[model samples]
Target: MKENQHLVHHDATTKTRHGQPSTSPTSIVFNAQPFGGGPGATLTAVMPYLRSRLKSLGPIALHYVGSSLTMDFQKLTETKWDGIHNVDLYTNPEIGKRKLVSLLQHLKPQLVVTAMDELVAAAAQAAGIPVVIIDLLLWFWPSISPNWRQAELVIAAEFYGVQERIISENLNNVATVPPLGPPARTTQDPSADVLLNFGGMINPLMPKQEYIAYSHLIYSAARRAIELRNAALPESQHAKLIVLVASFDVAQGIDPKDPEAARMVLPDEALKLMASSELTFCTAGLGNLYAAGAVANAVLLLPPLHEGHAIQTHLIQKAGVPVDAIEWHELTGRAPIDYYRDSLQVMDNVSKAQSEVIDSPQAQTALVGRMLAAMLRSASAGVSAEDPPLRTLIKEFGQDNGDAMAVQIMDVLEKVR
Candidate 1:
C-alpha cells in the first residue's frame, strides 16, 4: 500500500493517445499459458478492457510472460507490454522462475495476474506482491492448487466455474467473476447452417495421432452434413457449413479440394464464429463451450480425450446445458458422423424422452442424461437456465467488465495504492 520509495519507470509501448506518451504509475505482471487456448484467449479478450480501465485511473505498466516453449509469442506482440518474456515451464522450470522473478522485481508491479498457473502465482505471492488468480478449470475446492489458495484475490468465472466457484467465492480473497469474454453476436439468421468447430486443439489432452483421428471424424461428418443439406434443399437454398480450425491445427486437413470448407483462425475469431453459428459441434473445452452458447440455435459438444473431460463436462451440464449439448458418442466410439447427421431429430426425441423421465416419480438426477437435454430446443424459450445467469452477469458487470479478471485486479491495485 505504501508508495514505492524506489522510482521505477518502464515506458509502455502502448501509445496512450496518438502521439501522446504516458508513464505507468504502477506495474502489473501477467503470466499467461496458451497451451489449451483457454487461458491465452481469455487474457486477450479481456486485455483491451483492462488496459482502458487502467489508463483512465492512471498510467500503469504492463508486462507479460508467455509460458510456452514453442508458441510464437508474436501473436501477443500487439499487447505492447513494457516487457514480455517467453519461458519454457516444462523444460526449464528454474530458469523460467528466475527470469520471471527478475522481471517482477524490476517492474515491482502493484499486482500480478495468472491464469490457473500455480508456480507463477506462488512466486508472486512469495514476493509479497498482491496476486489475482483466474480459475478457469473450476477445480475441486479442496483440490485447488495451494498456489491459488494463497492469492490476494481469486476470481472464478460464472459458467465454467460457477459450481466450485461457490466454494471458491467463500474462500479467503476469492469472488465469482461474471462470465468473461468479448461481446457475443446476438443477431441470428435462424436459418443458418452448421459450424463444425473443434477449437484450436494445438495442445491436445490426447495423443497427437489420436487427436488427428478424432478431428478427421468430425471434419468428415461436417463435410457430409454439407452434402446432405445441399441435397435436401435446392442449390440456392443451401446453407453455409464453415469449419474454423485453430491456428495450430494444421494437421486437421482443411480439404484443399474444397478450400472454402475449412480454415484456421485466431482464438477470438473462432469464438465469434462459434457464437454466430446456427448449429455447432465443437470440442467441449470450457473455453470453446462457454462461447458456443451465445447465439447458436443448437450446440452439441465433443470432448477432447482429456483426463478431466468428465468433470469439466459434468459441471457445465449441471448448470442446465441440456441433455443433448454434450455429444458423448464421439468419445464412446459410435462414430461422430451419426451424432451430427440426425442431431436435430436425435435431440428432439431425446429431449422429450429425457423430460418424460424427469417428470416421472422414479427418476433421479443421476439419470445417464438427466442433466442433459439436446440443445436443439428452439431459442424461443428465450432464456434457458444458463442464460439467466449470464444475462444477470452481463447486467451486473455492464456490457463488459474491462476484462472481468483485470478489472478485479485493478481494484486491488487501487486499494493498496
Candidate 2:
C-alpha cells in the first residue's frame, strides 16, 4: 500500500488530493449524478465504504461529474477526493460525452466507477477506460436496457435482488453487491416520536405535488397512531408525538388544501426530533432510510418510482427492520382510511424489530468494506476487460498520424468544456 499523501490543494471548503496518477494502481471514480437529491444521497451512503476500501489499496481519488442543481459539490470535495469535475450532460449529451472521454484520456485512470447512468459509463468506455457501474437506482425501478454491457464489473445494492439478477441475466460480466448503509451515527440518541424524511428534487422525475401529498399522509398517520397509542396508555406514560422532516424544500411548501400536512422542520432541527422520536415516517431514499434505521427508528417508505415500493419493502423486510410502504393513492386520499391504519400498525412494530436488526457499528463497517473492495476491483480492471475494440481502433490510428481525428476530438472536447 502507498502512503497517504495529498496530491492536490487543501482548502477549508474542499480537500482535493491524490497519491499518484499512474495506470499501474491508481483509480479514478466519476460520480455523474451530483444533484444532492436521490443520487447525491446514494453517493453519501456509499462514500464511507468506498473510502475505506480504497484506503486499503493505496491512495484513491474521486471526481464528481454532472450539473449542480440542489447539491453543493464542495460538501463532497471535503472528503478524501483528488478533485471535482463538473460535466454538464443534461444540456447536451453528445458534447458531454466527448468532453468526458477527453478528460478520462487525459487522466489515464486505471479504473473508472460510476453509478447506473448510461451516458457517463459509455463516455468512459469510449476513452478506453475500464468501468464499474453501480446500479443503486435499480432498487427503485425495474431494470432497464443499458448500452454498456462491456463493463468490467457491475454492482448494485441488494434491495429487492432484482438488480443483481438483472445484471447477471442481461450482462454476463456484472456482479451484484449489497449497498452500504448510510453514514454511521455520531451523536447520542435524542429520541423523537416520529421522523419524516423526503428526497428527489422538485422536478418531473419527483413532482412537488407528490411530495406534498406524501408529507401529508405521513403526518396524518403518525399523529393518529400516537393518539391511538396514548389512548391505550396511562396519562403519565403518554408522550407528545414528534415529527422531523429531513431534506424538505421549504420553497415548495405543502398545499394549503391538505390540512393533515406536518409542519416543516429545518435540517438542523431533525436531530432534535430524531432524538425525541420513538418512530419515523419517511421516503425510501437511501440516506433517510439508513439514518432512521441506524438510530433504531421504525420507518415508513414512500419511494418516488411507482414500482419502487416492492423492492424497497422487500429489503426492509429482509433486514428485519420495521417498515411499511404507502401507495400514492393512499397518500392522495384516493385509497380508504384502512390503508393508513395498516401502515400505523407497521410502525407499532418498531421496538421489537429494532432490537432484532440494530447491531453495533461493526456490521455497518464490514458491509461498507465489502462494497468498496468490489468497487475497487471493478474499477481497476475497467480498461482492459471492457474496451478492446476501442483500444484496437485507437492503436490503428496512431496519435501522431491522425491530424483529422485529433482535430475532430479536440473540437468536440472544446465545445463541451
Candidate 3:
C-alpha cells in the first residue's frame, strides 16, 4: 500500500517504524527552526504541560524533525522520541519539503507542532495535517504571514512593542502568549557572578571556524571582565563565572582548567543557574533574551551572531528595555539604524548578514573591549530596582504560556482525534 493511504485510517493502522503493532492512539510530529537555542527552549517549556494532558489518551508517538544541534540541549532527556529526522541533511529546500510531506504521510500523525519553521508548517499543511506553531519572534514575522497562516494555531510569545506593530487581521489563527521559557526559580543562587551563554552557537550560514572564533572571543572577554571586577573586591568577595555549553565542539575549546567554563547544562539547570547568578552575559537570541529577562536580575548582550539576533536586540533596545549591549555596527563603522534596516531585507538568510560581521578581525577585537565595557557598566550600576529591566520585560510579556499552549494543543487534538 502507498504511504499516503495510511492517512485514511491513521490512528487505527499507525505502527512503529519496526512494523510492530502501534500502542499510541495519537501521534505528533514536531519541528523547530534549527538555527539557535530558542526553538529547543520553547519546546522544552511546553512538553511537560502537554504530556500531562496526554496521559488519558495512553501512549502517544512523538517524532522530531530539525537540526541535530537541537538535540544537544539535553532538555528532553526523558522523552521517548519515536523518530528523529535531521532537517539539516536536506540542503535543498524543494527536496526537504517533499521528504517532510512524505514523512508526515507515512507517520500519519494526528497533529504537527512547529516553532519558527515555515518549511515544516507548510509541509504538514500540504499533507492535510493540523499544525500548531510557536512563534517566538512575533515582531519579525510580518514578511512570512501568508506562509505561517497555513497553521491551524499560531502561538506568539509576547514582547514589549508587539502592540505597536501592525499584525495581519486576516490571520486570525494567531494566539498571543507570554514569553516561553523554563520555569522561574523560587530561590536565587548568589554565589555565581555571571552566567556566560552564547546560545546553541550553530547556524547554517556560518562555517565551524567562525563559530569557534566568535565563541572564543566572547569567552575570553567574559573571563577578562570577571577578572577586572574581582580585582577590586576582597578575596572572599571574589566573583565566579560559569559558561553554558550546548555543543561538544564549542565545549572542547573552552579552558579545561576551569571546569565550570564548559558545563553542559540542561535547560532547567541553565535557568536555575541564570537566576542564581548576578548577571547574564549572552547574545540577543529571543529565547535566551526572554529567559534571562524573565528570571535573571541583570543581562549584558554580546554582539549579534546572526540577523535575528541583531533584529531582536534592536527591538528590545527601542522598547527601552535598559539592557546593555555591544552593538555590531559600533565595531564595524556602520550606523546601527542602517544595519537594522538592511537586516530586515536579508532576514531570511541570517548567515549572509553574519558573514559580513564574522569576517572582520577588527570587529572581533573591538567586540571583546565592548563586552568588557558592558560588563563593567552592569557591575557598577548594580540591580537596585524592585523590577529590573530583565524582570520587567518578562512581566510585560505576561506569565508563562506553556500550560495555555498545552490546553490549545489538547483542544486541537480533540477535534482531530
* Index of the highest-TM-score prediction: 3
How well is each residue in 247-366 modelled by candidate 1, as lDDT tens digits?
A: 444433545356555665665566566665555666666556556544444666654344244455666557554534444432232333222224344334333433343354333222
Give the Cα RMSD of candidate 1.
Answer: 10.4
Tell me which of candidates 1 and 2 scores higher on TM-score: 1
What is the lDDT for 180 in model 2? 39
Ranking by TM-score: 3, 1, 2
What is the TM-score (0 to 1) of candidate 2? 0.55
TM-score of each: 0.69, 0.55, 0.82
**Residue 290 of model 1: what lDDT?**
52
Instruction: Identify the leading candidate in terms of lDDT.
Output: 3
lDDT per residue, candidate 3, 306-380, as tens digits?
667767777777877777877656777764533445543444343343455567777656765665565565566
